[model samples]
Structures are given as structure tokens and as C-alpha cells.
Target: MDTASSSSNSTMAEFDYLFKLLLIGDSGVGKSTLLLSFTSNTFEDLSPTIGLDYEKNCWGVVSDIIFLFLYHEAGQERFRTLTSSYYRGAQGIIMVYDVTRRETFTNLSDIWAKEIDLYSTNQDCIKMLVGNKVDKESERVVSKKEGIDFAREYGCLYLECSAKTRVNVEQCFEELVLKILDTPSLLAEGSAGVKKNIFKEIPPQSDASTSGCCSW
Candidate 1:
């Protein structure tokens, strides 16, 4: 990876509001581990977030909204209340789960559906799924095709990466920001039925899901 002090890093700095991006999945899915890498460029084992954890950051075009990591063990009622409110100004969401954990990936739909209901007004909110822990060749539970297929069914972007190895970890975040600013008309997916309004843009999300245990 190129150093942030490099010339390439300067080019990546151009953007408006910092988008509010969420790291979500079931308990022990490595959501917290990946968050460590993202916010501090480091990794460590941690406990489930008590209520909601926050990370504020700016990544092109989006003014950082509060990034909330809903603990894996958060009850549905609590999530519906606390996490739901943060969506009022959310720009995008990054839902992640361990690739070897099928239950985590399966619950992606449930979270998405809930968001749609909670933030009905924020239709422009972009969401993507990340399959974490690809570094573990053995004990792999979910496959790439399955992840891609789920992304399609939910109308979201999908990719897999390993936080431990730093494979596609940074790139996924970069692509997410790009997707936020990318006018759907320019994308092949835009040609079909759904088309994001070029005039209006999604605001950064302040709050942001999960079922399978997130353990890294």
C-alpha cells in the first residue's frame, strides 16, 4: 500500500462531506477488528460494543456522519431504536461478516430490510457487504458467489477481503466512497429499473446491524 504521505494520497483527499459508514454483522464477525484497522491502521481483539460505537471520518464527498457499530449481541428492539435514529442523515453503510460464517451473511437481508423501514426517507442511503477473514483458507464457510448473489438480490455492492492480511481492506473503503459519489447513470446497474437521482445526494449517516456471532 502506498504511504499516505505519498503523492497518490493527496489525490484521494478530494471530496465534500465525510460519509457516515457503518461496520455491521453478527457478534464475533470481526466488525470491531476491521474497525481498528480502518480508524487506526491497527488490529486487536475486543469485546462486543456495549450499545453503539462511533467513528467519525471524512472520505470524499461525504461529511463524516457518526459511524455506529451495532454490537453483535444488540437486541432487535434496542437496535431498532438507537441504530435506527442515526440513519436520519446516513450517506452509506458497509455491512461485513466473516466469510467462513454463513449465518452472518444470511442475515444481511434482514438488516437491509430493517433499514429500509426505519429510514424510508433516506432512500439514497447506499449499502455494501464485505466478507471478512478471507485470509483463512481453511474453515471457510461462505463462498464468493453466494456473497455476490446476495448483494444482487438486495441491490447493493459486494466484495470479500481479509482485514488481518490487509487484502482489499482499504480498497473496499475506497470503492465504497466512490460508489457514494458515482452517479448511478454511469454504472451498468443504473440502466435497469432503479436509478439514483443525480440532483439529490445522500447525507452522511450518523447511526447504523446483525445476527451471526462476529468473532475474529
Candidate 2:
């Protein structure tokens, strides 16, 4: 498995708030595409990530300055072990799913949320649920209302974005940062104050089934 970093490292002195953010979702859910689009502001053909991809972004300034350290982990089951290792100390998480694939959207509740509860550092860590690939309307199997409903039910900030078209791509990250800042502890002492998570275990997935387009 191959892993890569996106840019040169910046010292902690370069900004005020440094938030470690994690990107996670099932394979082909456009996690990498969103990251590339957000950081570089352009869409490029991307190979499926093998292990992990890292990016650093700095936003705001002076009293409002914030630095985001993003980690994009491969969604393939084979890399789950490697990716889960990075979950500790994350101040924010972006859980992505493909709006075109109903299976990916369903797994957010059935699979990904369990992983979040299992490995995330803090149960209260700012979370954002992103439904990606909105540009593919013809192929979409998930609706915007479904996305919003899921977010409301699960208590996460939600957004639909089209990385290929750059729709809501920048705003996605901007909103997540705003949410992180809304939590008081995360902004207290820059890097030194990152909260050690007290995990709230998610109950085991039952044999229960939810019928949808992907059921076939």
C-alpha cells in the first residue's frame, strides 16, 4: 500500500489553532476527490488511494487563525487497520459518501459510524457528514433530503458537494472549521489542548436490514 503527503510541513508557529481532521468513508465515495478539490481548487483524475493521503491548510488570521491538518485514509477494507490507527486526537472528522451510490450512503450508518465510535478520540469531536458527487445527478441514488435527514437524525452537520464541479467544496471545509471553533475546548490552547477522547462505544450492528436501491 502506498501513502503520500500533499505538501511541505509547516511549523506550529505558522498559525494559531491547529485542528487534526480525518476523512473517512467507503471505497469510491470521493473522499480523495474532495480533499484535492478543497486544497488545490481543481479536479484531477485520482487513482484509488492505497493507504493514506495527507494535506495541510491554513485559514483565517491573527486572533481567528486556524491550521487544518487533514488525513485522508483509504476506504478499502484491506486498509482499515492502517487507517484506524490515525484516529486518535482528531479534532474534526469529515465522513463522506457518494450521493450516486445508495450502498455508500447506507453504510454511513451501518458501518462508518461504528468505526467512528470505535476509534475516534472524542465522542464530541466536531463531525460533518458530506454527501459527495452531486454533479452526477443522472446516476444519483441518494437524495439531498435523505442526506439532510440522516444528518439531523444522527446529529452531524451535513452538506452536499460536487468536487468535480467545485460546488460547495470550499464551503464544506469552511463550515466544518466553524463547527470545530464552536466547541470551546478545541480552541483553548492551540495544539497543546487537543482533547483526549473518551470513546462512547457504538452498539454492535444487528442483523437488522434497511431496504433501499442497493438492496439488490
Candidate 3:
């Protein structure tokens, strides 16, 4: 994986495809932390995202693809009106829940999933159920089986991740992007150019080692 510090026209030209992916769930499920971990490979206690926050990531495995990630504030009713617009043009959605919180898990199906179905323009949008904060295993109320069951019932992929520990953080996005790449309809909508000044450039590095449970 690679990251950019500048979204120059030359930098944007390197991408072969572009995709819009969203991170959503009840607030405090670590949506912002998960994104921070994935993009910068670091974690910190972040204040809740106001309105919406997004980051542009240029990733490559087989080919270069630029991802526009929209992080939504899901727990606040005040943000409801903005959600319809947020769901537009999304090719992938990461529905997140904190494993220690039961309500967050339940709301994935009861609330967030319904909104996605109602507002998403792409009927075939790939969704992933991510149980975040798996490092708090002792406090976890939502078991792995339950997450799998929900994913199966919801017709989406599932995984448990800890942003603080960096467990499966990279895998989460990689799998989502791979699925989008595999889908013919999504591939047909790929764009090569992105608006300038959206991302920063970082020198490429070898894959970072991920170890331990909660320690960063």
C-alpha cells in the first residue's frame, strides 16, 4: 500500500481507477480511528467527526486505485438530512460496530443498513460488517458468531478489527477494494482523474509489521 501527500494533477494521473467508500455505524464505534489507522498507520483518541470527514487514498496491489472515503456521523439525528447525499455514488460501505457495545451491533441491521439500502445509488454496493475494538475481548458483548450471523443475514462480508492494535485494519479496506475491483458493474464506473488537493504524498514503504493485541 502507498499514500500520497499531494493530490497534484501528475499524482492524480497515476491512478487507473477511482472508488468512493464509506465508513458508518453508531458514533464512537471508532470509525475515525479505524480510518486513521488505515491511512496513517497510527491511532489516537479522536473526537467524534463533525458533519462528515473524508480522505483520499491511492492504493495498489495489482494496479493503482484511488479511494475516496467518507466517514459519516451515524449516531446523531441532526446529521440525518445529510446522509442521503453521503450515500450517493458509494461503491463500498464499511458498517462498523464496537464489539463491546451490544447496541452498536444491533443498530447495524436496524438503523445503518436500512439507511444504506434506502439511499445508496448503487444497488450492488459491496458492504462489510466490521466489529471494531476487538482488543477489548474481555468486554466484548458481541461474539464472533453473532457478527458472522449478521453478515450472512445482511448479505455482506464480516471481520473483527482493532484500530489501536492495527489488526485486520489494512485487510478490511484491501478486501473491500478487491471485491469492488472484481465486480463488473463497479469496475465499469471507475474514473482515472480526481479533484486536485485532496490527498498527501508519502514515500512508499515495505509492508508494516502488525503484532500484539492492543499495543501500538
Candidate 4:
């Protein structure tokens, strides 16, 4: 809920906890847009690329610093080899899907989770199922109840967000961070991997007016 210090600006921060999180899903889903939305709080018509995009953000108080290294991987098949490498030592993996694309939603367990299990150092990595571009309610092929049900069955946190509208973007990250903060076992489990955690519950936030861009 407080102003966050971006990775671009926090080169000298004295961080206590460092976590690596990956944004992964189908190629056309808004992983990069979500990253930009969180870090810069703006949206752009970002062209798809094959390389990994990194952003850092610092949260919590000065004494209990939490630094997150966010990696937005290109979802194209050509980048699969490269993106999988980024999964090493990841503490959190956000499996994103386009709400308007039924195929993308269906691929959550079949494609992304399987790939994550293959490369992720921590098998019990914090997982979140994010349905992006909920702003396109008219064209949405995936329903909120369906997303929640799938996430529940998959044992992952679930959220629907709109990166373009900046709705739930902050909450998405905050919820993941809170989950990490609360689970000590997960933090200690990172073992030589590029991840860690803290013990703090994510406080609930009041739902306010807010409003991702995705299509089938």
C-alpha cells in the first residue's frame, strides 16, 4: 500500500530479504504489461521480444527490507530454453492467463505448471494463478468463478486483474509477497536457490474502484 522503490532506482538498498519471481504464461498473455504496470504504473503497447525483462522493487520498512527481482519472460516457444533458466531459485511463480482466451486459461496446468516444475529449484514455490485483462468483461471467455475454482483445485493463489486499468496489479504482487512473508518453511526451503522469504501476513485492503488488456 505504500510507495514502492523500483529495481531501477534501488541499486544501493540494504535489503534483508531477496526473492526472485517469474511472470510466465502463454505467448500473447500480458506478462510484460503486468510487470510494467506494477513497476511504472503505466501501460504501453510493448512489442513482444525474446529476451528476459527484469525489474526490482523494494518494500517494507527500512529495517525489514524486502527486495523482489521480477523476471518477465517472453512466452514464445523460441524463448522457452532461455526462460526456463530464469526459473532456477525462483521463490514465486505467477502463472498468468488471458481471461478472454479460453485456450490460455486451459493451458495453465497443462503447459506452464509442468514447465515450472521441471526447472524451478524449489518445488514448493509460491504459485499464483492470475487472470489478466478482466477489463474486457464483454469478451471474456474465462469466468471469475472458474478461475477461482481452478486455482483452488491446483492449490495456487488466484486473482483477476487488469494491467491496463491498474486494477488489482498492486494487490497481486502484495498478496504474493504476503504469502511469502507468512510462510517460514518456504523461505528456508529455497536452499542455495535464488529466493527467500519473511513472516508477515498480507493485510486485507478495501476494494476500491479500479480497472488488464487481453484478447483471444
Looking at model 3, report the run of 10 residues with the lowest lDDT sum. Answer: 207-216
Q: Tens-digit lDDT track for model 1 on 126-161?
A: 777889999886989888888888889777788788
Tens-digit lDDT track for model 3 on 104-147? 99888889989988899998899999999999999999999999
Indicate which candidate wins on TM-score. Answer: 3
Model 3, position 72: C-alpha lDDT score: 49
Computed on alpha carbons, the lDDT of every model, listed in order, comes to 0.56, 0.72, 0.75, 0.73
Alpha-carbon TM-score of each model against the true structure: 0.67, 0.81, 0.84, 0.81
Q: Best to worst by lDDT, what's the order?
A: 3, 4, 2, 1
- How many steric overlaps are in each model, in order? 19, 1, 6, 7
Deviation in Å, model 2, residue 23 alpha carbon: 0.8
Q: Which candidate is the best by lDDT?
A: 3
Show where candidate 2 strays beyond 4 Å.
Answer: 1-10, 189-216
Candidate 3 Cα outliers beyond 4 Å, as residue runs: 1-11, 193-216
TM-score of model 3 (CA atoms): 0.84
After aligning candidate 3 to the native by TM-score, how far in Å is the CA of 14 from where it should be? 2.5
Estimate the TM-score for candidate 1: 0.67
For residue 24, give model 1's deviation from the true position in Å: 2.2
